[model samples]
Target chain A: MTTFFSVAYYTFIENIRKKIFYGLILFGGVMMGASVLLSVLGGQQTLRILLDLGSSAIEFFALLGVGFSAVTLILEEMESKTIYLILTRPVSRFHYLTGRYAGLLMALYAGMLAMALMHVSLLLFNGWVFHARYVLSLFLSAEKILVVGSVALFFSLFSSSAVSSLSFTVFFWILGHFSGEINYLGTQIPSLAGKLAIGIFYYVIPNMQYFNLRDFWDVPQVMGNWVWLSFAYGCAYSAVFILLTVMLFKRKEF
Target chain B: MLRLLVISVVLFSVVNAELARGFAYPLAFSAADAAASYTGLDIASVVMGVRKLGADIAWIQLLQYYGTPEKPLDEDRAFQLSWDMTKYLFGAKIDKEVCFTAGCDDKSHYHPQIDGGVYPLFLQYCYRIVALDPSYYFTYLYGGGALAWNLNRPQEALLLLEHGIAVLAKYQHASVRDIHEPYWQLNLYVSAIVYRKSGDFTGMLSLLETAVGQPDAPNMIKGILANIYQKQKKYTEALRLWINIYDTNDLSYRRRAEEKVNELKKIICINPDFSIA
Candidate 1:
């Protein structure tokens, strides 16, 4: 456990030093600030636009940060022969992989937190009434980013190239948000094989709709047991991908 | 590796199913109903789970379309002073002065021909907007009110309101037996439009009064009710509504409200206690 946390700390420090990390954080802040201009066109819904657009900018930039970092975490190490140096020490592959993932998540979430702070400040400047759901929405967004990072890491291990891993992760991201449509299609299709195929796709992809709490946070009676279930689902999905990533890493020649 | 892969797949399927059973969203991604220009946006918003942002874009587009001066149908007379252009440039104050200087009577100035024209694509814009984000209550209110009163198309307004109510029903709690505020507000708009369609002016006026009294009622509704009171010669009531609209500080209505309040005050000074029903 000590080794795991040490590896995590090292990875976190190293990843934050990259220029792209700082660029993403800067871009997120600029995006939240730009929302003020966009909200002008919303007429009476200026505050709503500010709140929605700012939160979306935070989530989107965090997803991009996680995707870039996760897909490159292992591939860059292998390319630079850094994995051998780490493996030569008294550290197991499980600890190293989990630690690297934890560190990647830490850096991405730190960036998200900075963006969220800017968003909150902007909202307050615009006379936005504070709601507890704002925190819940940010928390759910972090969980969604975590799932994406784990999936990207798994793809990096299973695929041959970082480009392919990134492409697969993005494809899955789109499919995940479309899971509701896939479920609807499963019921609408008449053929048995088509239904089976749609069913498989539905279950295989992560359902991003489950984490889209920001869209309906104001709705009454909608956040009962479902919120907890969605959280559990995010954790279980990430764990499955992480475990698979470990299995793939164990078989590598390096 | 193969055994672990199988285990991962099984675990993923089980967890996903459990969440799927308990979770329900009020989204129905239907590209069939959207305008051709907005179909791509509608699909992208649903696929990317950014429906609210897409709706905002559509809302802004609608505002721009309605806010712009309508083009003249006759090519040769296009540059001449179109009524909409006159209204856009001078607003109510200068437009009224221009009409009076041109020897126009009060009836002709106040009641422009309802059948002179309508915005052809207003209902289509409303449909495209709500199709992207059905929970956008303002679209329903603004679109319905504009259609029924401004465009003289109460039937179309009722149609839009019905669609809004039906779509919003999906968000209602199953066993709560109580309606949400947006849904109830929409029903109120429907009844007011119904009264308007039947030419029951008193009924429509009373219903609108009730609507504007709600805490969440929009300034647009207040403006509409004030105009109605002004038309009926109820100067005191008109002044009260205009004052309320000015206090809201909504930029879209503030200038017009200020003008109405000043104009109504002058009319009331002549006969301080006089009011017509």
Candidate 2:
């Protein structure tokens, strides 16, 4: 446990040092500003424009940061033979991988925090500030990020670079956004191939859309039950993905 | 790809056919003629149709908001089309993949929120679309701001404008936000229009004063003061405003100003005292 904490702590620092965190601020910041133009061209749906842009940008940039970092960190350590050195120490491979994953997860959390600040700032600027629910949305967003991070790490067990791992991770992101529709469409399509694709994709993908309570948060119209249900689903999905990542890493050759 | 294209085309045609069949035949020719004379056929007809659809959607959304509606109504077809368009605006990347056409962009500018839905409900829907495509400005600007304002919902309009501005601020940064700063200015103008329609000239003037200085304010707005002055038979002051508009602005509203100038001339023609230096 101590060794895991040490690896996680260092990994968090290393990931933070990269340009990814800055990119998060820059991308999210830019999107918030662009909402003004959206309001203009939007004709009369400005609030919708601002809220949508602010929340969406936060989700996209955070996902990208997590996916890229998870894949790159694991691959780089392996490529540099750093994992071999760590393995020779008293630390077990599970502890090392767990620590690294934990660190990446923390970095993902930091990226989300940076994004949440941007969202809050944008909200304040727009003069539609909400506190309690906004913070909940941020927590949900962070969980969504973890799902992506875990997927990226799982792919990294065999991936050689962040790009390849991200490619797979991107699929998960797409799946997360479209999971509901996929399930809906699965029922409509009669073909075995179509049903199989939809069914398999439904289970395999992260289904991030389930956690997307941005609409609910912005409107604050949804009941507490739905919010709780979404949180439950997100937590369950995150745990499953983390377990999958650990399993893949355990079998990976050093 | 070919199969998908064929399927989409078929679906599109079927949907249009159904819609066409549902239209009131002979089109209430008397009422249609009166409306056409004032607003022109295309704009008039489309607005009336859209307004009706919006009204239905609004009622449904209102019901949904109050928890009165137990089931989604068929009126949601229009809402869903707008929803899909909003989805596309956000980089869903499904526009090309789908066989049927639906979604918002430069072309399909109607925002469901602006049309007729309950304010909060529509806000949630619009937020989803904007989230997907923060760059698509029309959803927030025209849909939320202008339409809602015209519909006599200023509070909702303010909310929409604020959100839209924030999104643009984030993506485009302060510089681009400045470029589109006229939009924020226009919101004030719309407020003036709203007040003017409500017979609150004092409030209108106050809003217009703020609006005219905005980077994007049209010259016509400045001329509006002159027109208002002319209404009061304050021809000389009106003339000065008309001249200011004529001297400073470009051609965008030249014709409208020309008509206003002619109107001012008629006022002076009736009373020699109306002439200004």
Candidate 3:
């Protein structure tokens, strides 16, 4: 456990030190400011508008940061042969990959922390009410980042460059939001063949929309189970991707 | 030992937050961005005072704010926001996507959605935009037109159009502003429809009067105003405008004016002061 954490700690620092990390953070801060500025266009809807903008900015920038970092930290290390340093140590490949994933997750959390503080401050400054549900929304957003982080790591193993892996991760992130509708269509289809084809498409996709709490920020129906259900779903989904990533990494000559 | 405790708590808190997240789904603080009393408009009020340019930027941000919709759950709401925001801010007419032409009876005519909840804020947004840049003419046209035609809230639409007319009147009269006399008359015409809907007969006549009185009123204005009076059964008033249009000799309106003048002559001859309504 200690050996695993040591790698995680090292990877976390390396991920945070990147220039893009700072850039994403800076961009996030600017978005927070913009969200507050745009809030007034809302009239009586200002609070909901601000909340949506603030949270979305955080999610968007943080997802980018995670996607880039996941690809770069893993793919770059393998390419440069620095990954051997950890693999040759007491750490196993599973631990090494898990550590790297944890590290990237931590870096994302740190960024999310910064964004949340800025968003909360803006909310307070604007005399907006604080809803505890925002924390859940932010948490779900972080979980989404983690899921995308794992996806980025998985894609990096097969895809050659950071760009390709990041691209795949973003593509999946977008497609996952449509998973619910696709799954609904599967149920609607009459043929068993059609249902199976769509069912496979539905489950195979990460269904990242499950973690989308932004839309449901105000709506209450069918969300009673979101807390445990999304947590289990996000964890199970990310774990499967990470396990695949670890298995794929083991096959590499490095 | 204490350091370990701090780390343990940090990890536990992270885990607990997720647990509560699922369990709480939407906790108290998340449901509403604020209590009923706490609105961000107060902050906007302050920002507009200090940052004049920021207000302009804020207007853009407002469009951005409006365009950004939460998803999965907010798909409908956000979709409306983007649709309306585009139309209101940019003057892009958004046709209802679901409408079908003649053969399909059920979907033949499109009824633009009127989200009652979102309707009230329409005027408020347009007012703020104009307040920031008083000369921004499109805001008034698009917002006022939307309120009247789309939202079916004619009263609010009339108020917005009137405010726009008032703001442009001085510059419009001087022919200095980009807003021309036709634009003024068009706004009044839109207001006239609102007045007609609200059962305000005098208001509708007043609107037509205002349009007809414009120095640069279109050559057809007298005919149009006369037609309105003819429908109201005010043959005397109708005759007067018809005569004015007839004197213009604008071929497009002359025939209609002459026909209306003859029609009104017969009516006035019958009673000398016949006012059907």
Candidate 4:
């Protein structure tokens, strides 16, 4: 456990030192400004447009942080053979993958926090009424991104660094949003075999619509069946895929 | 056993974070606007190069641009747009002169269209959002609704819905959005209603006729068509549809159908040649 924490802590420190982290945080702040610019284009939906832009900016930047920075941090170490040094010394494969995932999440958390603070401040300054639910929803939003990171990590084992990172990103985004379409297709194709195939595809993809609280930004959130359940489901799903990643690493040679 | 428990604990702890976050957000300090309001979608924004999701970026910006406090209502378009940054950050109400101006009548703040070529641009922005991500069905509904109802431009809404139906048919001709659609119907229902709103009731009737002919048209669509007939004073045709509604298990529909039937019977007794509708 200490080994895991130490690895995660150091990896976070190393990632924090990267210039891209600062660039991402800075871009999040710029999005707040962009919201003000955008709010003007909106007539009655001014406040909404502002917050939506802020929220989307956070999600977009965090996604980039994971794909461009987090995945690269892990894959590059392995690609450049730096993992061999740590693996030979005393660190196990499980520790390496888990620690890296934990560290990247911590770093991503910092980014999410900074951007969220900026976003909330802009909303407050604008006198916009917000429910405490934004926090729960935002946390879930971060979790969704982390799951994407886990997928990226799993892909890192089998593919090149760039390919792994980019593939997970495209997959995470499309599958998350398009689960609705998959459901639509499920009913369209009448063939029994086709229906079964579509059903499997739908279950295999992440249903991001659950965490899509943006459409309900102003609506108060209850720990209702959908909200808390979606959060729990995300964690369980991420854990399984990440465990699969660990399993893949377990069998890999130097 | 311990290792499995440890993993479960860790994952479970992540779930707890949501509970903790719900309690802490209100304590956060409010922040002022960090930067000045940018003018139009200037060269800077345009040239920045959308390394990804260009249409989405443009779509969001378009939303913000329309929602801004000093919506472009001023007689002098360029001058009104030049409202100082302080005016925005300070949260000043729109200038009286701007509101009184011809293009700026937004008393309710739901100005879907202000003159100065802004409102009409709703369709254009919808075009951009759709072009960027063609599978986004809701945008079509939104763009269709705004144009048909708010802007009084059902023609544009019809065209947009036409495109939406074509695109959606490719992926979701059949769907499970129960309240939104029933099976393969209502994809074209949106466009049909827009026809009705634009005073093309004949066009609306014809579209519904086509929908009625379809083997899978939902009952809701059928009821709506029947109601339109009642409004148009087609008593006999409406009576037959009302009987269908009365036969159904829906109490509310049944009650309304019975009342409508009784009223239509009296009208039919007076006018034998009631083809005026």
Candidate 5:
């Protein structure tokens, strides 16, 4: 457990030190600040505009950070041949992979939290009354990042190059959000082969709508059980990809 | 690798099935509708999962469109007059504006005198906005109110409000009396418009009064009610409502409210028992 945590800590520290991570966070802050100016355009809906744009900025930038770090963290080590030094130690490959993922999450979550704090302060400054849904939305956004990061990590191992992996990850991200549309199309199309292909894609892709609690923040039907179910789905889906990533890592020559 | 893949697939399938049964994803707008009203930013909003932000952008565009003064129909008039002379001389055919009406009260800001007060594609803009984010209740209220009151097209307003009601039906609570209930509020707006259409000024005033009394009633609605009160010579009531609107600090109504408040104060000072005869 200590070794696991140590690896996670090391990965977190290394990832946070990257210039891209800092740049993304800075950009996120600027975007959140810009939301205040944008809110004026909304007239009477100023508060709603601020809330929507601010939270979106945080989630978007955090997702970018997660995608970048997930593809690069282990691949960079492999390319530099620095992974051997860790593998030669007493640590197992599974621990290394899981620990690195955990660290990536930690770093990204920390950045998200910072942006969220800035958002909350801005909201409060503008007299936004507190709501538990804000916290729920932020938490669900983190879960979404977890699932996407895991998918990216798996692609990093499965694909031949970092560029292809990043591309595939982004493709999946887009597909994931449209999972409902894809499923609906599956039912609409008459061709048997097209239906079969869409059905496979539907089940294979992570359904990001599950973790899109922000979109449903004002929805009255989304009760506590639904939240828990979505949370479990995020964890389960991410675990599936993490397991696949571990399997691929175990087979590598290094 | 085969075992791992099987495990991953099985795990994903199990959780996915459970989630699918427990939670329903919100339905997106139909592709046909989205394409019909597709602005460049709207396509990005749909793909990027920022529908609310996109709705905000569309709302701003809608405001800008409405804020700019409508172009005069001078060219259309010239063409019509020339067409009449041509018909008198040579019997030439000319198309006339089908929806034109005469004697429209140009003095009223809310009443659109030409083309039945319908701005070109105003309803389409409202439809596009609601399609992007149905939960944006303000779009429904603002667009519906403008259509019914300013455009003098109560039918279009009712249509918009009904769409809002249908889309937001799931959000309705068991108690319909709640002021914060978006469904109930929309119904109130619909009823007020219906009363106005039927020429029941008293009924319309009562409904507007009830609506503006709600804690969450928009300042725009309050401004409307205050205007009605002033017209009816209920200076004290109008003054009180204007003060309330002024306190809300809405940019659209604040200056007007301040002017009305001061004007009403002087009227009351001249006659302490001021009332419409």
Candidate 6:
């Protein structure tokens, strides 16, 4: 476990060295800045626009960072024979994989922190004190990053870096909003098989909506019973994904 | 003389016809001038642009018809200018009709229901705006919180206000400073209203304190604070603030304060040792 953590920590440091992290941070800052300009468009909803742009930008850039870092971390190391040097030592494949996963997770955590700090600084600068829920959102955001990181790590085992990142990220993004749409569609479709297939898929896929407490936090409303259940679901799904990745990495030739 | 007389009649008929068509801008300007003493861009930049275009077109038509600048100001031209200005400000024919309704009763009823059949069409329109830009706190604040809350749809207001705050939080965390402030204020305001309405006085007090300090804090918020204090039997403080409001520049707040003061004074007179007194 110590070895695993050390490896993960280093991997996270390596990801921070990449250009994409800086790029995403810059992009997010610019989007937020643009909100002031958008306010002149005559509607009294400038803050709303700013909030939407800021949140969407942060979510997008964070997801991008996680996907890019997780995708390339293992595959690049493997393709360049860097993994052999690491693995030729007394370290096991499990340690290597776990280390890499931890590192990516850490990088994602750091990125989210930086982004969150920037937003908070803005609020403080504007003389608006922080709300308690904003702190909870940080935890929730981190949880989301964990889920995102797991998907990318799992997909990287058998696939190319580009494919792994794209596939998993797309899957996460689409599936995040899929449950609600699928449930709505369930009533419209006439065939029983169609409904059954959707039902099966629903169970098979992670219900991303479960992690969404944005509705609760925004409105100062309490999260429903399902929010906690969703956390449990996320943990279970992440665990299974990590286990699968470990097994796949252990069986690989190089 | 006969030829001149015939031409005069023809010009008069043309002018009357144009007046009947509603191009009356001079009349609009005169009416607008009478309404207020203040002078600024009260019509908005977009309306100004439309007015310029209409005026230029009317002038060109007047030049062509009269063949000189010496012709009397055409009533038809004035009507055309007013019609063009109204069109520019209001948009299509249907919009003009809707906007022209005396008290918004005709316009408010046209909203369509979604799956649940809960809200009418206009509410959906406001909801769509929030959906398109969840960060826009004003829509949820004024449109959802103020209007919808007054309309007795607290749930919907809460939902919108929640989403709006989430958007603000997301951006705020993302380092978007501009949205972070207003949204924070809006969140405080909405939550305060909800807490007050739900009779959660302590929670409401906390929110109201935050709200009064916000840049977008309404003048009426002071009244809410006073009421809360009054309910807590802090009559001296409430009365002090209420009296200040009566003496303040915000005329809209004065009447409410006066009424509250009168009612409280009457209560004190009726019951010398009343708990509130």
Chain A TM-score vs. truth, each candidate: 0.97, 0.85, 0.94, 0.93, 0.96, 0.87
Candidate 6 - CAPRI tier?
Answer: incorrect
Candidate 2: segments with Cα more than 4 A from true spot: A30-48, A191-197, A216-220, B1-277
Every model's DockQ: 0.42, 0.01, 0.04, 0.05, 0.31, 0.01
lDDT of 4 at B30: 17
Q: How accurate is candidate 4 locally (lDDT)?
A: 0.62
True-contact fraction in model 3 equals 0.04
Best prediction by DockQ: 1
Q: Interface RMSD computed for candidate 6 is what?
A: 31.4
Ranking by TM-score: 1, 5, 4, 3, 6, 2
Please, what are the lDDT tens digits per residue for candidate 3 over residues B34-104?
31122255344322121123234445443443334223337775677556544543334445432212234
Taking the tens digit of each residue's C-alpha lDDT, what string does model 5 give over A71-156?
98799999999999999999999899999999999999999999999999999998899999999989999999999999999999
Off by over 4 Å in 1: B1-11, B30-37, B72-117, B173-178, B265-277
Model 5 per-residue lDDT tens digits across residues B83-156? 54334223233343211124554432222233433486788888888888877788788877888877778899
User: Which portions of model 3 show Cα errors greater than 4 Å?
Assistant: A188-190, A220-222, B1-277
Q: Once superposed on the true structure, which residue ranges of model 5 sit more than 4 Å away at CA?
A: B1-8, B30-36, B72-118, B170-180, B270-277
lDDT of 2 at B26: 14
Please list the C-alpha lDDT of all candidates, in the order they appear.
0.79, 0.56, 0.63, 0.62, 0.79, 0.55
lDDT of 6 by residue, A1-254 (tens): 77788788788788788788778888777766764444323222233334434454566577778777777777888888988888888787878887888787777778777777776666565445567766665565566767777777878775766675668666765665455556557767899999888876655555554444432344312334444445555555666667677777778885
* Docking band of candidate 1: acceptable
What TM-score does prediction 3 earn? 0.52
Cα deviation of A175 in candidate 2 (Å)? 2.2
True contacts kept of 6: 0.00
Interface RMSD of each: 2.6, 19.8, 20.1, 15.6, 3.2, 31.4
lDDT of 6 by residue, B1-277 (tens): 2354355445434433332232111112322123222213223211221222122222222222222223244898556544543343233232222122124555333211111123333344444434322433444555454333334566666665665565556445334345556766766767766876687878978776666555455444566577768788877667656665565433334444665666666655655443321
What does chain B score (TM) in every candidate?
A: 0.75, 0.35, 0.36, 0.37, 0.74, 0.40
Residue-wise C-alpha lDDT for candidate 2, range A105-201, written one tens digit per residue:
8877776677677767776776664667667766777777766776777777756666788888877776565555566788999999999998876
